[model samples]
Target: MKELFKQIPSVDQILSKKEIKDLIDKFGYPLVKDSVRKSIEKVRDEIKSGKLKEKIPEMVFELIPLKVEEVIKPSLKKVINGTGIIIHTNLGRAVLPESVADYIKSLSTCYSNLEYDIEKGKRGHRDSHAERLLSTFFNVEAATVVNNNAAAVMLIINTFAEGKEVVVSRGELIEIGGSFRIPEIMKKAGAKLVEVGTTNKTHLEDYANAINENTGLVLKVHPSNYRITGFTKSVPAKDIAKLCKQKGVVFAEDMGSGNIYDLSELGINDEPTVKESVNAGIDLISFSGDKLLGCVQAGIIIGKKEYIGRIRKNHLLRALRVDKITYAAIEKHMELLLREKYHEIPVYNMIFKQAEAIRKEIEEFISGFKLENSELEIVETSSKIGGGTTPEREIGSFALTFNLNKSPEEIEQYFRSREIPVIGRIKGERFLIDFRTILKKDIPILKNYVSQLLSH
Candidate 1:
């Protein structure tokens, strides 16, 4: 067999450069001459070794490279977020508003007053954009921002009590979204961790007993992810503030997943507002920008003027300061909030949307897909406030459910393989695309996907 295969002309010997170019021209740029040549060479090598018997009809397929421009594309492409998870942490939480995106695009294109005061024609601070607006909106004396909430907390702890003790409730010492624990962060800041109370219960006396000569700050951390249901007790910020003030200690709060607007009107759980925290006489307060605030990722610290000034002077401030683009976005977000334009915030809109309104949208979208006599259906569904905000809270929503010719797993795989990935939860052996987290604008995209499914 080997001798006979050798006698027959090898694929490399049979196919010439001109022949390959002819094939490429017929099949478009995908049939690149170089790739075709390599394929033929491999085929020739395999045939000469008498391995042809092991090959199948599928082995005839050839992968050719198109133009370099077509082959190489940008990694940061737009992806469809159909997972019904809002503020999806993995897919870059809290998309910037169109105006904010434009602002960043402008800065990226040319030079601006990022670190220079254009009016004064002199060097200036980059943190200037967000500082004033953040303070004004949150009702704080001053404010500063960092890369993230954890960075803000570390910078605060390192600044105020590097070598001293920071008293906190053991229950409040929580592990955030990532495995980043509070106690570990404090230790890294060179502050002694003085934990107070038990896992489910803590009292003002516990904090009082922990206080002593080494005590520099009384810290309160908000349990962002989980809430203790029954038989739970903890000291309020007002009481802790009074006790800390009497003992000459700075009372600081880490209000993780910070919120500014009232969610009660939207039928969401009423979380403590940032203004309330500041009003409780806490000296320093830090919270996140992206979570409930519906802004870009940043750690916002707002508190008394004197304490903010001290934090600004700390050596770590320079390292943790936010960029001009972040500052601009945060400033714009605050402006919208302060002006009572809640519709501008995407998160608030998604959470507050009524069931009737969402149902109407889904019904309109399904109408576009005639389904070629296929049985397409719209059913009532439930949506969640994802990103670890409310685990048990499910908002009323609507979804387009139907029976596909293929199996449930096949339908899911097909949707995912589209130009834009559509991720959703599966229930009762059916895949679902909940419209609760989906915006009205994304309906056209969903329609296109449904059209593709029907065609297939």
Candidate 2:
């Protein structure tokens, strides 16, 4: 055992090796040295446990760099989403349009008038960056942006309903992705959550009876992730707005998945657009910029200028405000939407995609590549508007499926472990790469990776 320990190279000796020098250049000297010390200690422990029988210096040299990289691999990386779910929250929620991404890069690398008013030759407010574009889409008096919808809700509730009763329906108290519950957020904002009506139904009179002098705001939360069908009834936004007006209370809606375009033209008619919510006489409204808006993550609030002015005066606004890059992304995204270039946006492109086009692309890919040890076939699949947008509405789509000797889980892991990881879904016994969600530029990359995978 003692001789086996001696056979393992010293940390200093390993650090001096030429290949180790290459690792130092890549990972820096301090990290490489720390990794070498830990590896040496691990080798000593393995020898003490009688796991090593001979000098394996060659094996150690061959694996040391990989060990160091394993310790330093970044958790966040660019990955391909083949799951047919657009606006996938786990996969970065929304992908910026190519033009929007390029705009952000250009603005970020240099400097722009993020706060400068070149017209006035003085400082300007950053809210105008996206707020101006959003106002044209709705009849809103004013708008402001925060980091996310949750932050928007918290900020608005704190601004108007703190230490007061916030009347809401028990049916509308939704919990979206990551366990973000409506009641919990209201509590954090110091609002008294007074849940009214049943889990399946809520009426206009229920809200009217709940309001009193102590009532500050009536919140209507959109069930963006789930649905209750059959024998269910809910109050319309206009009726609630009228009731709030009569009671002299603030009425706001957390209209999740802030859609700006008319998706009904594309055969999706379930979700109501942000413009409809604005025209419903709602005194205040907020929605997510990432889900259906096809932009960066932002919580946009628009309503009466009086309430917006009050919100801007709140000290918490500073904590919840977005940075320059986020403003830049949202502004450019709004420009694309205003131009009616829906295809330029990733989320819209996926929603607007036809199943036939995806099939043709899959056929072309198959004809070009020679993948061994796997059978490729085209399959019909369904895509979804994920990130809690429109739930249960399956859009027609297509996938390139693979049937290999490996198990489904093993095949998924294999693609997931690639340099640019491919996240495909396993349905039945086959692995699927849905073309509806795949970007046009990524098709060649997918073909090359699959070839390398099966050729081995």
Query: lDDT by residue for model 2 over 1-456, one digit each (tens)?
Result: 766766888777888889999999999998888877777776777777888676657656766776788889987899999999998888998888889989889988887898999999999989988888878767688899999999999998999999999999999999887899999999999999998999999988899889999998999998999999989999999999988888899999998898776777657787888888887899889999888888988899999989998999999999999999999998888888888888788887788777898899899989887655447889998988888877878888889887777788888888998889999999998889998888888888898888876776
| RMSD value for candidate 2 | 2.4
What TM-score fits each model?
Answer: 0.84, 0.93
Q: After aligning candidate 1 to the native by TM-score, how far in Å is the CA of 300 from where it should be?
A: 1.2
In order, the Cα lDDT scores of the candidates are 0.77, 0.87
In candidate 1, what are the lDDT values of residues 1-456, reduced to their tens digit?
Answer: 555344443345434445455655665544354455455565567766777654422233342333322444565666666666677887677766666677677777676687898889999877677877888887777888898989999988988899999999988888867798999999999999998899899999999999999987889998877777789898889999999999998999998878665667656764678888888889999988888788898998988889888888998888888877787788788888878888877877777778788788777777776766645676788876666566666777887676877776887787778777777767787777777777667678878888877877
Give stretches of model 2 more than 4 Å off.
6-26, 56-64, 265-267, 370-374, 453-456
Give the residue spans of candidate 1 off by over 4 A.
1-71, 372-374
